[model samples]
Target: MSTSGGRPRRSRSTAVRRRPADRRQQILDAAARAFSEGGYHAVRLDQIADDAGISAAALYRHFPNKYALFCETTSGLAERLAVAIAGVESDQPDPRTELSELLATIATTAIDNRRTGGLYRWESQYLDRSDAEPVRSVVITQHRRMRTQLIRIRPELSRADADLITSAMTSVVASPATHRASLPIRDAQTLLRDVAAGLVDVELPVPRLEPPAPAGLAPSAKREIILAESISLFAARGFHDVTIEEIGAASGVPASGVYRHFSGKAAILEAAFWRASDRTTACITDALAVSSTPREAIVELVRRYVEVWCGNRDLIMVYASEIGHLEPDRRTALRRQQRINVEEWTTWVVRSRPELGAARARYLVHAALAAISDLVRLDRSSEPARIGPLAQRILLGA
Candidate 1:
């Protein structure tokens, strides 16, 4: 009864299922886990069925094939995005805060809710017209809604410029460069806040959001191994430089068996990237719950962020140096994602520091990113403590 894959790769020989409702949810849940872990291409119905404790034949009875399942998976994510943003109506209040709440939700949803967001992030490969128009239309509409919001917030700007800024900011959120390799470290919120500051031109501070770790909540040893190996592969080679073959060998999984966990290279890359973004965002949100003042919040936020940025420089190198190597369509989609991450950061920059105009804030945020991203890709690790002090100087004037 389980469906697998973003678009489940189906076997023609499987028998069709009979019960519609129960069967569909079973398939969808399995599909969700599978798609979230890998992506559409890696999903296989046999695997889904096994996860669901059903025969492959039973799965096909409800859904026609893999493509059918993919359509179902990605169907409403973008529409919800549009709807969520559209609900943030407020001309009387500070436009910057309004945008932050709206965008923060997007970062959380896109970065955390793996199935829906994963489809939003990675399903472009299957977006042929023959596939379906609903998901595509929803995403477009959501983007358009965001554009309108940008225009209102920056009333001094031209429509084209507003659109451009909107486009650029959204791309930042989705970018792999902003994604942390495997944990909700500090960089997620920092990168998001940076992008927003870059787009809107602001001097607001980054806020911390993570809470203290509870018992039994730390990452497992297995997760660490995956991250350490991926960092090497992504750093030395580009995204495509190391294959699942290399990753499997480095991580100690059987090459053929890697598909059991991750179906393809891109999906694996996406997962690794997701680990970075999700953990970062979680950290920020958690910190926000406890920090008493904006300055303290910003300090902790930046401290965690600098540590993460320095520690994972190799992964950042792999992500940045190799992203252009992705197929053209993926490149475009990821560009949009990258924008979102930046805009999230930019929002905080604007909110916390009202001194600079939008233009100046935008410049500073992007400039800061430019200054720091270089350090991220550097392979030399001799000077261990440089990033923290430097980041404090940038944000805290300490």
Candidate 2:
């Protein structure tokens, strides 16, 4: 088929040709946004290519596979953060000023990369150890830098305390990535900086020594065993990746036995969620009952939350990451329960600080919770007592 003039009409292609370096950057930017929004397995190469305004073949020309692209995207993000604070000097005359400036830089970087910064939090689990290590190393280095400055400001802080506070502070600055809460850029930065700075003065509780495990273990019911195994598996590998058979095997039961104990994997997940919700509700009740004032209740609530998170890190991980895989009705119910819990905290927060309107109180509540949850998620050795005080500082603005 020819045009009316009997000559083939040349179609004008809308694609813009990019230099090699520019095209690579474009692909990485698109992939980072994609992976941050959708988890690793859910994102497709062709989709990223489309986002980058390139053909699939063109995408392949730069990166061999999606894994490579993902590694590059995440590593690039970590490197960007490292660069943001590279010039920060701990030798500055005023340690508080130095830390403040450092936090300001971090706040600005977090806001700038808010769209894609979440990949390191949620999707890094899918990365291989070799691919993940460099990214982790970069983050650890940044944390060390912040810790150094924090120690400089507070000379009395022990190495462990400095590390814990630094982790909490960084988590607060990075909290924007994990949620969709929006604020003006300047307001967001100031909020993060102020909250993080508050953590500097937080007095960590003395680290408690744990007693050794008992020599003998009491036998648990098969249902409890299955539930426990499923939570660990789901936390270690996401819900979608684990199978009923695998859960059964881990629990030393057959797949048929697992069905007898629970309906399926989703049922197990739902049970885990209910277990978490019930515990949280119990803590809230206990906190309110024992406290004489709203401030005391909030502090007690933070203590309880930190204890629960530290003891049940895997369970908290499952609760945070696997909510999307639950049945719609169950998911909605659990989410509603979460909102109720947050509302309780927000109420106490507003009562404790009437100057802070309900909206700002809720904002602080989320920031404090995110700071605690993320620190627990990232550090297995995080002590509850230490984290509890930092969380209190954030919430109480102490």
Candidate 3:
């Protein structure tokens, strides 16, 4: 019998064909749960199969390897999430509000898809060289898309600021699952809203929770101690999603004592960021001082920077975000340092690709710095092999 759509209403055979697709979903769901609750290293295929209410052998028929299945599952989830975020419905007239809806979509979608969220939490690392590069391309496209939309809403935004905010917003939304009992979704939404608003020259008054107790860290160790804690949290949670108290607690310092050393949470963030950025700049700067070829110097600098930071990327997250939150004087100082560093970067680029002028060189440097900055907190520190390839792409653009 023909159905209204001009197809057979149901055949036992056709019905059976649909079942595998559904079962694939079930396996993905279980895998997400297993991966999210515990990361990739800990996930067990047998247990995942059990969670899916299937035998391991059956599951293997659908997904031969755990990593392969995970990448397939999470790739879909990320795409769906990216689409949901891209299609946010809002009419705020303000760029920030629009961006807020978009980010809120990401956070809420993740929250709703607790299993997938867990998968993201657990299996983000499994997206290795092959898996990650395509996703990065998609992300970059989305970034450019959103930035174009933002500029339409607020034309005053500097390309640098737009790029920075876009990067930070992405980090915040994709940050780990929060145990924030009272205000997880709301808080996440608000952070995005405020960031977007700030982009459009609007002032968003958000609450700042009370600062934690000051820690008795020696001057030299204070920064390291904070970096130690912040690296993991930022690496796991991203910058906007993590709080000062969490950093303090993770660092094994009494929350209150941390404030005694810095002015405020943002300022603490500011200090921590500069520490790492300066170190990186120093390494690069020092390399530039002696190396003959600008290209060689740049490569070595990026190589050293990548090696050190990828090993401890959580610190880089703090560096990436914290600098932006500083006071004008502090921000100026930090920017000045970065500017001097960029001059070297610009020189290298101009020499290698003569068509790319100083302005383009600066943007290239910024983008590369932005990408490399993320490596600090990578869970698999052994991903050193990945960094040189990334460095080449970012700085050289071939």
Q: Root-mean-square deviation of each candidate, in angstroms?
A: 15.9, 4.0, 20.0
Please give the lDDT score at residue 234 for candidate 3: 59
For model 3, how does the per-residue alpha-carbon lDDT over 163-213 read when each residue is reduced to its tens digit?
544554454444334221223456545543443333333222222345423
TM-score of each: 0.43, 0.83, 0.43
Model 1: how far residue 23 lies from native, Å? 4.0
lDDT of 2 at 323: 66
Candidate 2: regions farther than 4 A off: 1-30, 42-62, 87-90, 122-124, 210-221, 236-241, 261-263, 320-336
lDDT of 1 by residue, 1-398 (tens): 34764665547677565555577777877776666444555467898889877889988987888777767766645555656656766453666666666556565555554343545544454556755566667666656656666666777766544544454455444432243333242345454545543466422232224542343443546545665677677666445457777877887877775677666776666666656666556656665566676556555555565556665676665554444334556656655665565555555555556664444344434434543554444324312244333333344332
Worst 10 residues of 3 by lDDT: 199-208
Give the Å shift of residue 81 in candidate 3.
1.8
Worst 10 residues of 2 by lDDT: 210-219
Alpha carbon deviation, residue 18, candidate 3 (Å): 14
By lDDT: ranked, best first: 2, 3, 1
Better of 1 and 2 by lDDT: 2
Compose the digit string of candidate 2's lDDT tens values, residues 1-398. Answer: 45899987556674465567689899999999877765576578998999999999999999999989988888888888888888677578887888887888888888899889877765457778888888888787888778878888788988888888898888888877766666778988888888899898888777778862453563499998899889989999898899999999999999999999799888998898899899988889999999999999998999998887777899988776666566568877987888899889999999999897776677678889898888788788777777888888888886
Off by over 4 Å in 3: 1-21, 86-97, 118-125, 152-158, 180-398
Candidate whose lDDT is highest: 2
